[model samples]
Target: MPAERVCAVIPAAGRGTRLGLGIPKIMVEIADGVTVWHVLHERLRPLVEHIHVVMSPEGEGPFRALAAGRIESGAVSVSVQGRPTGMGGAIFGAAPHWDAHGTILVVWGDQAGLSPVTAGRVVEAHEKGLTIPLVPMPDPYVEYELDDDGTLLRVRQSREGDECRPGGLSDVGVFCLSTEGLHEAWTRYLDEAAPGARTGEVNFLPFLPYLSRERGWPLTVVPVTDPDEARGVNTADDLAFARRAHQRWAR
Candidate 1:
């Protein structure tokens, strides 16, 4: 059979609360005189067929700026989810429109860290099966901020995902949700889940562990050897550090 179609879903709706930049972290300037994700999308387009961006309800302007003077007048599409709603909600908002038989790539638009080669590597892994981009956080000297049991929890406030793999899988926001798994999760969530009791948000990561258990989905972790190729923008400080790292690595 031919190669599977790659339809990408980029979640760019986060509030960037830690940045205190009064703007979404995705809009932050990096080298090349463009916002960070701009560079990412430039490298990513050649490898994928369609690109869908999920942004905050109030994010149309900044998101549009990221695509300035591009030939992708029709190739890119943007959708806004009403809530700061978790990453899960953004994907759900766009589910009805996603390609059912194609592999769906989920990436954080704020992560301007992938080399074109590394981006191709993710697509290669996706073609194989369920996969996640793993990376050793650059601040190695500081020691990871882990749980009491020494697991690297992605977030402190909502630390819940379990370590199905031994070393506690490192999930860089770049994820490859297989078509089968994506459809399975979408169907189950739409059929069984009630709106969130409080913020009415949906959490997508829950489905990863659940589908892995329920449908024998093989969730595999593909660790990125170069840490700089997998960093994410969360704060102004992180941007500064990554810029330095990017400059060093780019050359």
Candidate 2:
């Protein structure tokens, strides 16, 4: 069977207050002439049909300027996420720019060093339902729970006050989902779901298990051998770590 058609949505609305950068962290120069935005855009360009970068109103100008070539070439599009409603809002906010009938690949803007090889593997493995790449992190900010038979039961998120143990399976900030499935699930979430206990906003993580257990959607877990691929450039330390990881990966 041929690989399903896919488009990408990048949620970049965060202001990166933790990095202490005046601008969004996605625009920060991770390396000479290369920004965090550049890394993700370049990595995802060849894998999908097009890229939709969802940014805050404040970030539109800079991001558009950075994505000029790809935008001109019709390989990328930009949309605004009016508020910081979290990841779920960001992905759905860009909904109009993408093909609703095709698969959607959502990647967090701060996530860097994603391996093209592993990305390709996840794309190829996404025959149907939801496909996600899982990485083993020493301290998991968000952990996925799977049953003995490798079935995804639920997800525990530390940001939402869930107790997370050490050495857990975490996502690499990449996901492939069927558009129809996402639409239906998101509709249900909006109507019936409550705001996260800690975040006080709609979250995307919990919906994963909701789709699997409650809605009977198939969840495929692809293992990522390298943990560096899950690095999120949120803080100054994270930015430095990403820079170092980029150098090591470059060699």
Top candidate when judged by TM-score against the true structure: 2
Clash counts per candidate, in order, are: 0, 0
Q: State residue 195's C-alpha deviation in candidate 2, in Å.
A: 1.1
Q: Write the per-residue lDDT of candidate 1 for residues 79-159, one digit (tens) a residue.
A: 888767687878877876566647777878787776767667777766545676666653331112233542333321123
Stretches off by above 4 angstroms in model 1 are 1-4, 68-72, 136-167, 187-201
Candidate 2: clashing pairs of residues: none
Highest lDDT: give the candidate number.
2
| C-alpha-based local distance difference test score of model 2 | 0.84
lDDT of each: 0.65, 0.84
RMSD in Å for all candidates: 5.5, 1.5
